[model samples]
Target: MALDTGMKCIKYLLFIFNLLFVISGCVLIIVGAVIEANYRTYLDFISSSYLSAPSILIAVGVLIFVVGFFGCCGAVKENHCMVVTFVVLLFMIFIVQLGVGIASYILSNDVERFLHENMLKSMRNYDRSRPGVIKTWDVIQHDHACCGTNNYEDWTSTPYGEEYNGVPDACCKEHVSGCGRNIFNFSQKLNDINKEGCFDKLKGDVEENVTILGGIAIGIGFVQLIGIAFACCLAKSLKRQYETV
Candidate 1:
């Protein structure tokens, strides 16, 4: 009777974990699908460098969720072989989640650093009198000339282009209208604008996906630990059942 009770407890715990996993998994899948749908928008808003990998991470999250659902079912049935199979599959999912989380962290950090350094360098070389403030500005202008057409035209022609123009003034500093001009102020202003833009992109991406990713990571970690505990308890119960029989 005690052995049976123990087995029942394990089954209940497995059910609970499975339910939680399914719910979280479904949420993750939905979020991933949304991101995949608007991937181009994300790429255009944020750095495209991180887009491919994050999309893959989302796909993996969806797969783990589906696998987790099956594992839960297997555990609830009290089929020893099925239980073992579930455990093995859960372990694999945990491993993959860990790897993907780590990769995402590293990739995000690298991208952040690149943006920071590049923006600073561009700001340091900004010249108001020049065609564009810094390298990044030049790149943005070249790529998005039509996107910011009105602002670009104003910046290029007007005397107080740095002030009256719709473009962020920080990127468009005043250039002394003479020969042998010093552009230190112009460079500083450009860097500030680049920094602002970099931060904006980072914030936008985080707003879009950080919460969903974080929830999946936490949910998966919790499920894996609980699943392991339940598996151990189930194994002990099975051992007792065999001894009694």
Candidate 2:
């Protein structure tokens, strides 16, 4: 009777854990989607391959839902095979998530130079006629409160620089018609325009995103350990019960 009661408690705990898994799955999906959308906004500055982390997270979220179902059914029915399979799936996913989290953190350290190169390349190709380039640069400058890849002076060599003799109006501290005109004048430049580079600001943002992703992945992976242990205990109890019967 004591053993049966203990096994029953473990089964109920597993059921509860599975419910939490379902909720975590939903949260993971949302996190992945939000991050992916953010990255898309800066697609011109980032490699498409950088998207794989979020994509994997989204897939893992869906897989968690399936694994949760298996866990719930196995616990409810005391099905040994289902419970063992749940453990296997949970363990495999835990490893994958941990690996991705570590990899993301390591990659974050190296993204600065890559992003700088891309930022400069995109800046060189900037043209009003190219709406994509124009909009991206304008949005980046205005939103980040930054002027060029390195500094406001960096734009002085661009085609737009030749025409305007100053930074883009988006770089103006207090935007007004032609506020950026003649900003090369040291006093006016300091007073009217943002002097910082977009590269450092953007690099920090990207690194922060990846770091958050890493933290979430590793955190969830460790949390899944509890579920794995519960599944294993339940599977073993079920196996013993079957042998005795």
Candidate 3:
């Protein structure tokens, strides 16, 4: 049951590819976790369906790592059953990953609207004491040194407008102890207002992160195509062993 030179070459190639696949899977898991953990500021604007994508990638990454092990073992042992199963799993995972990437790209176009709406809505809920989304707006506004969704005046539409009767303290000028106290008199404090908005910055950050994730998906997808081709070739070569016998 000797394998021909070509079959041996393909088999070895498949093993090497699977080893790389394992590493790739581990990377995806790490990347996904980071996205899920640190994306709170941006993801808070996205719906649950879009937000769950990172978690799904984490799960798929773990699965790919496990499945890749089967592939390496099958290629080494020249086991037909294992090789076939590995090929099937790789193909399925490849489709899923590509789909995720495409979907992410599509969503990016409309994400600006969601971000604008969410930020405006969140302005009304800005409070340090309350939990969940209460702190999200404050953190983004304070850390990013911006106000409202578009500018200082965006807050005027929210109930927060009446509650604070002016801009939040987070929108104050530097070194001004009671900068926001003049919130009522925008004309008097024309030089003190923070004219920049949070929407553009937040939108930029979200686009950047989503672009990275989509790139990961596309990159892995290409590798899966190579792996699938190698597996199929090696599977065919396995039949050569029987022929020789």
Give the residue spans of candidate 2 off by over 4 A. Answer: 1-3, 30-45, 50-55, 125-136, 157-159, 162-165, 181-191
Give me the candidate number with maximum lDDT.
Answer: 2
* Model 2 collision count: 0
What pairs collide in candidate 1?
A: 123-191, 126-187
State the RMSD for candidate 2.
3.5
* Tens digit of per-residue lDDT, candidate 2, span 63-124: 99889888999998878899998999999999998998999989987878888877777777
Cand. 2 TM to true fold:
0.80
Question: Could you tell me how far off, in angstroms, the CA of residue 112 lies in candidate 3 after the best superposition?
Answer: 1.9
List residue ranges in candidate 3 displaced over 4 A.
30-54, 129-135, 175-182, 208-212, 242-245
Clashing pairs in model 2?
none
| Model 1 C-alpha lDDT per residue in residues 141-205, reported as the tens digit of each score | 43432212223333333333343333433333332223112222455433323222334444345
Please give the clash total of every predicted structure, in order: 2, 0, 0
2 against 3, candidate with superior lDDT: 2
